[model samples]
Target chain A: MAILNIEPNIAQPDDFYEALIDMHRDLDAEQSRMANAHLILLLANHVGDEAVLREAMQRARALVPTSSDVSTRPA
Target chain B: MANVDREYQGLAFDYVRSPDQDARVAVRHPVVVVGAGPVGLTAAIDLARRGVPVVVLDDDHKLSVGSRAICFAKRTLEIWDRLDCGDQMVEKGVSWNVGRVFFQDERVYSFDLLPDSGHRRPAFINLQQYYCEGYLHERTAVLPAVDLRWRNRVTGVTPDAEGVTLAIDTPDGPYALRADHVIACDGSRSAVRSLMGLESKGRVFRDRFLIADVRMKADFPAERWFWFDPPFHPNQSVLLHRQPDNVWRIDFQLGWDADPDLERQPERVRPRIRALLGEDAEFEFEWISVYTFACLRMERFRHGRVIFAGDSAHGVSPFGARGANSGVQDADNLAWKLALVLAGKAPDRLLDTYGTEREYAADENILNSTRATDFITPKSDESRVFRDAVLRLAKDHPFARRLVNSGRLSTPATLHGSALNTPDAEAFGGAMVPGSPMTDAPGTMRGHPAWLLSCTGDVFTAILFAGDRGFDEATIAAIRALGTDGIPVKVLIVTAAGATVPSVDGIDYFADDDGAVAARLDARPGTCYLLRPDQHVCARWRTFDADRVRAAVARATCND
Candidate 1:
């Protein structure tokens, strides 16, 4: 069986999107990045499945133009 | 400007002329302790208690200037109690146990350190470093063997085959003194360490912290409060602790680039205080300092006839309050071994254990303080992201709360796998392993109130558990013989709750009223524990055997 569900999982996708945007309302750019990081960690913990998180990470990394050299990438 | 608004009256020791200054040749002493800070004073008192004459020299004639180290842990308090000053420290200091952690504007959680309490001392006590040094210095007055020379400095050190000779300087002039052993207790910028050409090596943190002690009449509960990215001080962390005399200590995390000199000024500090407390809040500054700390230790604490203890040997950041607390523990671990060596009862190799054991403890402290420092002031963006994530999630999830590291707080390091310990031959369960310190429990002694620790005096103590029935004749005879042996061992017979025990002239008995002592030690009917002079358990057994106890004592003193 597949560990992660790639299907549309959120029942109310617009409500989830609205709440996520609302969380970053008064935050600056640096703070918005911090909030995003916090949200990722919280959701990852809530998921509580390593293979699923790892699969999600790989799928997400494929969408972005990642640098081949790890050291060259911004922290 | 420092300590100008202090409530406790500071003490100044008068610099008296030492008769050794006029000696034609250097007078030989058994042991000479350099520096008169908390560590040196404690070493002097311990040596004097063990019947060793120690000459404690210091360049200054007063206690520490400001309230540098305010958090004294339970283990340090017990060591002071053995030195005969724990009561004064606990009485004068503000004892506290609860600690609250906050994220942004909300308190995430609060923790009680001493949740179950039969301990004589609290989890921690916040007392000014000056008051602690004063109490320790005062304790040395009654010790006739302690030759505490004020305003006398160790200018030079020369080690040789027999002993170490120290060149001293005083207001009168300079003189030379010889000692069989020299214990360097002078702090971080140790003069003795430099004179010996030894260097402490480790990582240096590139962050600075500003500490301000403000006296106010606000009624905040006596608890440690820590905030991470609070609105009052955005992004950085802040720690608040209540000290005695209504004084509060506030530590603001300043990044590596902040100017230390400008940050400590009242004009710069006033706005920060006003932001934390309201603008109309009335407060007077007691002390302010901007300091950067490093986690480091010397390669070895022992060199030939000279030894290093306290901040002279190891140093950690103040986040965990491990610097002074660990230094005090170093003195505690070394004093007994040094005394035995001076008395010619233990082999010279025994002193090496002090180096190894406390070096292990130093590494532990350094590791903990370094981790806490990294969490408080993240070195990189990724680390900061993870730290903030933990702080944010800790408010709701218990698992995330475990990831939060404000400070582990100071706890005694069990000397696991120490050479002095006799390996366990029987199965046992408890925190009190062979190399662990004895846990304190409250009980009655001879119908009066007493504590389990108060019974373990400065000697080899064996605590025997008497379950329903008291000890047999052979066991009692063996304990008596051990008491009269070459190395006398004191016995404290612990009877179970309501169990009757016959009074013996030589051995003392404690009634375990609440069964806390029995539970803490995992004791059975004939279970016994052998504790060293410093109160660290060296051996234990399911049944008492005279030969095993004798051999264990020998091993503890490095006779085997």
Candidate 2:
């Protein structure tokens, strides 16, 4: 086992989360998309494991709303 | 050290009546540069270095009043290095890469402008514009080919087939001069551009900023510090940067309604300064001013023999440190091309490439600064909401951090698809691509420590990279034939660690030890690169083709 267990990997996650939010703060649509792409590559490099990255990608996609899933939300 | 008035600089270049001072009439010069600022001085130096005599005229003899245009990007440093004053400026300048951003009171994150070492110069250096002006002025004074005239105001410009004639007004009186070629490096309100009825077209940003220079004995490290809605200023943004001479620059973004005169008053500025530096931070005022900028440019940089460079050619907001930096590059780009045309090395039509290449750089600087300005000063309610949301998210997530743009620090403009470049005949992957400034790599020349760019000194250079695969003497001699004693197109053979140097006169050999230089250039065996006088890689190949190399060299020099 690769020991990819989640035990609050980053200390002060709240602070880290705030910093991330600030980074994306004010970018236009095209820039925002590029930022997301760059962020993924950066984090993936840090993770550096094909299996772990695939698992994380799957988890992320599962949480994202599809077109069909969007109809369930309040208009 | 001087008076606190922001409008005047204590140091100035000695303004003497020009040797061309014919009070009754005019004088004819080979080249005339309008404006004695950094850009004009650079253009004059480049021309003089290439053997074209030049005369530089300026309305004022003093350095820019404030600590203006503080950040010198690496590419600009390289360009300045070729002009013979880069080392001096770097020695006196403070170099740094760390930039910190704060949202409200909490510190958000910090980023490195140049994360890696192993290069000739750093990512950025902070030096006052006055220091740069002083060094350039000193360098220009010693040049035999340049006649720098101060307090010589140009009032009119009339262009003709042979050249252009300028009407000047000096303290002694008015006179006229004819120039084979004229370069407008005048400041934003270019008299030459205006006289020629040329106008820069673009949107003028409504937002204004108050720039203040303060000096104190604080122990803060020299780095860029930017704040979004900082606690002291409440909703407005503030930026703090340290410059040479213990001077600190502070820029406060004042909305459209800011009272221009009122904001610059010492009374109004003191409270904010106190809050930002703490109540008792004892700082003496050096200079202060309010300014507005627009990201605008002329439709074309070249108008026959009367070409425009610097702020006269284009103007961008000061946020990205692009104004003076890009303008200096314009001077560099045009100097070599103009020199070639003047010396009959290339056809007159070659001058048109200057406009095309510099226009590309101007557009890039404008685009980057525009985006940064929009992000910094959101115009609409929707934009403000989005900005605040991003800022809020930026504090927490790495993804949000990527969206932050505090004026993406200036980088070298890649002139992709330039007309001067020879497009790669074969697919390749490497740093030294066609139309890109040649990247520096560590190596030894003649068995001594050196970098690749040091060999590219102010001439048409061909770097023949023959690694483990040895080169035949005939081929080496053939390449060497392209250069003569008078027409030196330096041909250097680069080989990795102890590869026997090919025996050929007039062919320089360099050892790329440890393969660091070769790998950096992405050069395999038999790779050859042709660089322009500006050290920009104009053409490259996987294998050497003697005839093809000759043609590429000709094309690069505008000889084809």
Candidate 3:
């Protein structure tokens, strides 16, 4: 099993959005694709509502494709 | 006798009967700041920027003499940048990052400030205080709202519920003037403070220090060099700092019994300095003065409508170079408060924080200067023995080596008992609380470390975690109410997995980021943050509660 380690409990939507924008600005297209997926998932986990997390996951998946070769994990 | 116009700069003057003849002319301003020193000039500039009419008075006929405070810290430079003078000051100042200490002709320790990992500004810069004053004066002259009145003095000051009135004495004549507020930037012997019946309370050290500014021609390292002991001066030490104009500021720790008259004589002091140099080097003395160190702080920074700033409020030994720096900060702190109160943006209670906060900083500076003084001049025999032992140990121990090598020794100001600060149970546990000094991190507040973040589209929101599981829905609703009439809050709740959510304290429940969602929030749970206009923390809570968080925001931004 490919273990996807996600750090839970994202605080403050404003700060989360700022981090997202910063990552998008700082990272390249390929890295951003991978990072955005992780960010969305992390944000969903903090949401803690399983239904909301599922809906956010669908929105995130449409934005960035998750690949088997690539592991969606935080460094 | 020559006559000069005391009203405007560059205006030539005709002869007058006497200096008192010029004192008859009266000038009026909404706010009058006494003293044209660095603190007074800076306050005038800031107040002018806020469109407050100001008149600055100084009794001195010319700029100050000597190289009095040559060191400028980083935060001060940032403030200078706001005044549009940072680039000029930085260009003219010399940057030094390394320092060395010598004990008994042997180098005891050395340290490098460049490797400190993250510093927004340089460790230290050396520029003569005269240049700083001249730069500020030149800038203040261009500000139309600011009037610089040289050779003007306030002989008396009286305050009532209405405003502050000053009995002003100009070279032309004496006049009575009234101002909304009066700021005293006069030096340590502040006549304003004396008239206010406030006393500076602290210890006065007996030992006298001799500071000499001289032009030296030597191939010495361009760094702060200190000799702990000299052969001829067994108990005394020598301190040398390089200045911008190729001049050197040299200080000698003279014993308490040293004769001031003989020390002032070049014949006696010059030989002693020459002997330390080993070879007979030719140098010209620019200025020399003997001063005793006193760690004193005013009991209260304000009395009625009159406010005390800079040396008038506090005095510290020169060892840590905190005197001038802290004084400038006092001016910075007070100027903004006075401007706000005058402009009617904040309540009168905001002015109360200036005394509470600045007095705390003044006391901290006194403590640091006192420590430096005690280390340099051991008061008791036991302290002397211990200092000597530490110097000996510093020669070999790596920890001691690190301590001795970094020549700059001063503590950063802390926010405790500040009217702006709120109580935090886990403030020391790495949570970004309100009133803490701001740091430069991507998610942190820009100027202050508080949690005020604004999104790209101008939508503002705060983030809180379940650090103590204390927040509830009502509190969140209260904070959301602060949103603009149209802009609704998008709340995001962060909670630990498998842990029971605690009872609501006051925060509103938002969406949680758990499992894959956690990757999106990017913030740990149990952490709460509030952001303000510039995307900085207005307030933060470890546990959640809507009402408390909203109240904190209101308090910080003056909404309440």
Candidate 4:
């Protein structure tokens, strides 16, 4: 299996992070969550390699609270 | 200036009045085509080329009223080339392959449609639908086998086991006639389809669009421009294309609740046009129309002696320009099968493959068009959020740009799983797969420069790329022995780049020249290909044998 190659491959990493945050401005808590879910799925589909995608998913999931989804996460 | 007026004055062509109805009532003609539009005319012309007598009936003598179906795709052009009009169309059409898509107020990206060369036709051309019909009309006029009647409308159709009886309404009077086959080339609102109790079943899009054709003097390049939520057209999309005769076709998306009547008026639309093209941009309104469409197809395209071609078979939203393009394709796919069946060369079941293949294409067009419509006019907030995100990401990211499907431009449909196709029996590589239409390449025919596809109709063509051992007299006899009149298959021996193949009585010879044809087909010197009359591949192999070629030809004609 191929290892994940997620080491700041974007040309301008800081600008991409700023753009992601800017997308959520002026939105309520629920809208921000929906936008996050959409961005994840969009980026996942773009990175169609399944092994790399699973690695990215696992790495991101480790940072979030396991019980954080009980009340607020999208179904 | 070539006159393009607001009103349509029908081109003056000699309209030969048919003889008295009583005199021709009992004679059953070989083929009768209803609705002498582009599709019907193409079907009639192709049949006449194969020595089939055809009768074409049209309600009106003129071309289409508005500048509808302005984009002619490459495959559609190739089909027209077979009908003897593709070169003239490319000359008269405004050819372009670049398209720019804008999101909100910012230009997201631009793409080139045809990056490679050596093909006969370009990726796409913008020609008014009426001009297309006019070209078909002029070409059909020279063929005496086609009897075209103006002011004649097929009012009723009666189909039986062997033939069909038609009641046609004429300017002089109503007349009854009979034909061995009836091909309905009528438009989407097919009266013949309605008479058959077939309903075009699909959800009517709540969305509507306004199409305005304008003649203007502008320096903008001939490229397709699409906008999503521009500052001028707020909260809606706009598409602009350049057509021949200095005419510009523009489409504006209006919400479901927009008043169609008020939106189509020139006075109300001029300000919107001015906002996009500056206020001082002087332009004359040529035509205006409002359309709302659905993706629909008949349950079947064949009904015994009665067959449907063009808009009569299927229809889709106008986003991808699939309507007229697919209609032309429908005629191309049906004409050869009908000619063979009428000649008793192939079984009647061969006609069944026409419905199967074209219906497959109709489904593909509908699927793409419906997806495009949804992406352009997203239904809910959830969908719009993703659409905006994709558009926003596309500005800088290369991968995101490919996901943006304003309209996946029209391309040729592969007749996958067609009953008439024979899968390869030997090992091979790269294109020329069964059911794929053959790609065109520049080559020399006899001693003259020619496009390969322009030489491919009228009979089943087996292109034999002969190797060092060319073909001995016995081998040549084996190739000739594989065909009968019922399933006529002809061979073309394309020798290697420098080798010369001796020309025989009926076989055509061509050299690959710069190896473009061989490179395009990924073919070696020993490769052999069997193509249907319409230029779609039926089977291919690396070696040639008489028995295998005969079986492949038999399968292509459905001789069982």
Give lDDT tens digits, candidate 1, residues B1-560.
56632433456678888888888999999999999988999889998998999999999887776679899999999999988899999998999999899999999998888998899999999998888988887799989999999999889999999999999998888999999999999999999999999999898999888999998988878999999999999989899999887889999998889999999999899899899998998999988999998989999999989999999999899988898899889989999999888888999999999999999999999999999988988888889988988988889888788778999899999999999999999999989999998999999998898999989958999998886767778788988988998778998999888887777776788999999998999999889999999999999999888789889999999999
Per-residue lDDT of B340 in model 4: 85
Highest lDDT: which candidate?
1
Candidate 1 similarity to native, TM-score: 0.91
The regions of model 1 sitting more than 4 angstroms off are: A1-75, B1-9
Candidate 3 docks at the CAPRI level of incorrect
Encode model 2's per-residue lDDT on A8-53: one tens digit a residue: 7788999999998888899987667656655665676677787888
Candidate 1 residue B384 C-alpha distance from true site, Å = 0.8
- Model 2: CA > 4 A from native: A1-75, B1-9, B23-25, B485-488, B498-505
For candidate 4, write residues B1-560 as lDDT tens digits: 55743223357544556774667555679899998888998898899998999998888777887778889999889998888889888998999989899998999999998887878888899988788888888888899999889888778888887788888887678888889998988988998888877776765788989999998988778999999999999989999999877789989998899999999999988988998899898999888988888888888899888888888888888888788888888888989889988888888999998888998998999999999889898988878877877788789888778878888888878988887788766776666678999988877887898777877766788888887657888878877765454476788778667776666776677777878778877788768888888999988888777677778878888884
Q: What is the TM-score of chain B in candidate 4?
A: 0.96
The pairs that clash in candidate 4 are B345-B486
Per-residue error (Å), model 3, residue B267: 2.1
Q: Provide the DockQ value for model 3.
A: 0.01
Alpha carbon lDDT at B4, candidate 2 = 27
DockQ per candidate = 0.45, 0.05, 0.01, 0.19
Using TM-score as the measure, name the better of candidate 2 and candidate 4.
4
For model 1, the DockQ equals: 0.45
Write model 2 residue lDDT over B1-560, tens digit each, in one string. Answer: 55422332576556677656654556788799999888999999988988899999999878877788888888888898888889988997888788888889888888887775557888889888877887888798789998988888999999999889999898888778999999999988999999999999997999989988898887877788989999898888899888777888899998889999999998888888998989998888888899888999999999999999999989998888899899999988889888878877788878899999989999999999999899899887656655666676677666666667778788878889888899988877766789888877677876688877777858878888885656776776677677762345777788877787554555677778767767767787888888888888888888987777778877876677
**Clash numbers, per candidate:** 0, 27, 76, 1
Task: Give candidate 1's error at residue B186 in angstroms.
Answer: 0.5
